[model samples]
Target: MMITQVRRPATQLARLASLPSAASRPTLNTPWRRFASGKSKSNVSSHWFRNSFGFALAGTATYLGYTYMNGDWEAWIERQKEVKKEVIDVNDLRADFIQEKRSLKSPGVYTWGSNAHKVVAPESKDSDVKIPRRFKYFNGQVLRDFKIDEKSGAAITENGDLVQWGKGYSETEYKPTKTLIGKNLTSLALSESRIVALSSNGTIYSLPISKHDQGNGPKLRESSWMPFWGRQSTLSYRVLRPSLKLGESVTLIRGGLEHVVLLTSSGRVFTAAASTEHYPSLGQLGVPGLSFITRPSGPVDTCHEVTSLKGSKITQIASGDYHSLALSNDGRLFAWGDNSFGQLGVEFLPEHPFNDTPSALPLKKLYRLSIYSPKVTSIAAGGANTFFTVDSKRILGPEEDTTKVRDLGRITADTWSCGRGVWGTLGAGKWIHLQDSPIKVKDLSGLGEYDEKTKQMLPIRLRTMSVGTTHVAALLNNKTNLSAKNTDALDKSSDWGYEAFWWGGNENFQLGTGKRANLARPAYIKAPSESSKTPEPEARLQIMPRHKGKVGKRNVSMEQRVECGRHVSAIYSAV
Candidate 1:
């Protein structure tokens, strides 16, 4: 009778109240209800349980809603399961191209700073060397022709063999090794990342190099591929036919950053681009304006002949980072592409309709420059500037040794530069910065001696000059010393007496002045000696003892070939 009087549990009361009606309550036969009813009841409050249950339900709803809305739930799960790429140490992959221990047997070449490996001794670690050591591999071989770019270099041997060496992938060690063994490359030209070799038969071959993705061989693509997710990806390199017509023979090959200009034996010019889709504005291919067309497609992969110069005979072709220059047989220079720096030498009118459309059509034609007296003989295009070597004899007065000028036919040329002069590259003295038209480099006169009485430096004549991104190198006229009173001194001499002058930016010691300072005026570079102390066994063994002394002392005054790269300069010494 006492047990029957006990009241119903509070949980039961609460459960009954939560239901819509008594009929909605769970049946006693339900498994969950039966299990709950059998468990020992606690004295916990119903309000606290209700609050806890509400929070748990709200959190679960929020998580499910967010995942459903984002649409990346599967991607998130995939990322979580991805395995990370293994980190590699590049040093372990490095292998020496030269022997670890070697001796310097000859002083055939010298280099400085970052790209010293191109010519410096492989076993040597010095950044600069006054006396260049000879490469053991090319000990007895003479370097016939050589060209270098920012990071790589190619040299042609007298035997028509080409050798290449530079900083390989990951800045790993790479020795100077022979390449294109049987190709018989007579000459080679180097660009930022490409090498164009001119075979003895006037056939041109190009090899493009990539600093990344060594596993994949060089592959050609219709369009440049973008990096994955905006991250830098490995670049692929390969050798391919340079967009030429079938059986086309290339007499001259010039390379730009992403394009190549080819000159045929018939004096016709053609240009080919590496990736037109990526750099459509470069106008490197010299293709006509196709603005009326709607997204034209198909084989933009071929080289296009420059139709503008149809009747003109192009004698020389040169390319900059983004522009192309062609010098006609009549000494007429034509430039096009990327005129932002006025590199094209074209003036824009204020009222000219501007479309901002980069195309090869409607080309800018420049007829005259500031130095109008002398005609331009040679043209050179740098990163953002243009250079021309003018006939100094035409500009010189009647009394300025006309006899010497006639003797050295087109040999005494003065360099005129235009466009960007940020690092005093124009060599027009310190006051002038940029020159829209070609301006004479007043300070680049020939070698001279300081006159104490007049308190002025007498200038010598310049034989040849070369221009880099922001530097200039001039070869002084050794045939005639302008400072000497007698005109007979201008007589051609076997004694190599000309001096090499370098100026402008020397940050990389490209000026070869053994300093990192920029020179507003030209500075002299000393010639490498071939004394017994500076032994060149190859030259010694090849020559008779009487001619041994004359081997390395050949005519340095004849024509000192100067070549300039990004921040480096080189002189071609046949000896």
Candidate 2:
């Protein structure tokens, strides 16, 4: 105990001890490294303890890192979800904008650069079969009738006006040449003419063949071969009479082969059949019994107060090669004269004379063929064939049912027929080859090949149609066929398209195929100088004739229509 105090150092020494000299400071040379001395053992033990503490701290740090990762997973997931939602929202908005644009467009109205209607030009048999320049049509006209003459080399109107392809003053205003030069018109029938000009006032006039073509003027002379009567303006002219009438100031008249039909401003229909008192054995008068009689016939009057039959109201009268068709005031159609082929419709003929005055034969039974108990809307006649339509329900199936078609109590019947061999007129493909019965043209069949097992029921949508002694012409509303939708009639490798088709005799290029050969099936007709093509076979339907001209606005000529028999006549309304 006494010795312990003896070794105590001074204050300065104590301070010095707290701050050990550089040399006395703990050297790296420690006993802990020796691995042998007791002091070394103590140092080793302390070092081991310090190392253990550091290792424990590192382990704790690692454990804390794992814990942080596991506990913060929800936050990380939420952030990821936020980013994904933003991307999804942008995509959805873009898709919505695109869909909206598509819905705003209009459906089918403007066809790019085609007539959409009418047959195209016929295939050229030679370079001599030149294609003509076509003009875009004005509204309201649906290709009523047309004609082409290879000899004239120029297409003119039925009124004898130069409507297309000429030089200088005779040319049209636009790209295609269509000029209307005043000429003596012989008459007026739709787009055709037979009216003549009154030479006195340079006024165009029309009359029955019984009337005189007299009067003299700068525009016309009584003896002039042409029959147009009117004054001329600088560029064109003003019609003194667009149509012809019976008395003083009548304006329009129509001739149906042996019968002459007249229209008055008062909306009256005056018919004058060639009476059997003037001409002898002439088919131009009336039916056979009256063929030798040649006097004006009648003013077959109606009680209805209707004016525009829409082609229905006694608005028109046509004669087949040997038949007659009359359009009534309310669209009721009446036919008489010939009925050999049932062109007079399914009816019984009266064995004896029915009346002294010209009265219409009632044909209410014709409605049985249509859906809407058809009211005769328009009528077209062929040589030995006749076509008439009534406003009624559409017919497409074979049931021949009318119950489902009757809606307005009034319907329309549009039909056509033709004689045998000369190919007559009905548009039905090859059906009239030698048959004498009235046959419906094949309006439903297209020009393409099809199996009998898989045939489509086509509807005839004709705007206008006409017939010749050995041929027929028509203006059809271009329509799409629905046969492809019929599973039983589907053509696996063939996709039939919409087009203008014609069939029957191609003789004299009447079918416009530029060939004199005959065609029993429908053939495609091309447009002059046009690249567009008609769909073959299935798309072809009738042998349409082409005539270029204007109607309702001017004079007409005798050549506009050719009268051959007691009921046969051909009209070129497009002149």
Every model's Cα RMSD, please?
Answer: 29.0, 25.8
User: TM-score for model 2?
Assistant: 0.42
Q: Give the TM-scores of the predictions, in the order they appear.
A: 0.58, 0.42
Candidate 1 structure quality by residue, lDDT tens digits, 1-575? 32223222333444444445666545766546645677433323464588567655655455545555767567656666663323223542211101101111221333433455443434567554332234455543345577755566668866687676666322564567665556577776665555667787776655554334333544444233454434322333344344455666778877777677889877888776543224435555565563214224544434567777777788888777777788878667777766655566555333521212222221112223222244457777877777766553323444566555543332334666666777877777663454556666766533355556677544445555566777876665543223433211122211223455677777777776656778877766544333547422121001100011112433221122467777766544332
Q: Worst ten-residue run, lDDT, model 1? A: 539-548
Pairs of colliding residues, candidate 1? 218-237, 446-460
lDDT of each: 0.54, 0.37
Q: What ranges in model 1 sit over 4 Å off?
A: 1-107, 116-122, 127-137, 168-170, 210-248, 274-280, 290-301, 348-374, 392-414, 431-433, 445-463, 477-493, 528-560
- What is the per-residue lDDT of model 2 for residues 1-575, given as tens digits with 9 covering 90 to 100? 33224223332343444454798555577544475454556666797788567655655454445445557556656888988655534433332222111111110000011111111111112322222222233121222223222211122333344332211111122122343345433333321112222222224333221111111112322334456743333232223332334443333443433344444444444434322122222232223344323333432211111122224334666755345555667766555555455555533244532111233434444345533344555676655566655444444446645566543332223453434444534566564533333344555322223334546433345655555555554555433343333222112312222344444554434554545565654456543222336211111222122212223452221111221111111222222
Decoy 1 TM-score against native:
0.58
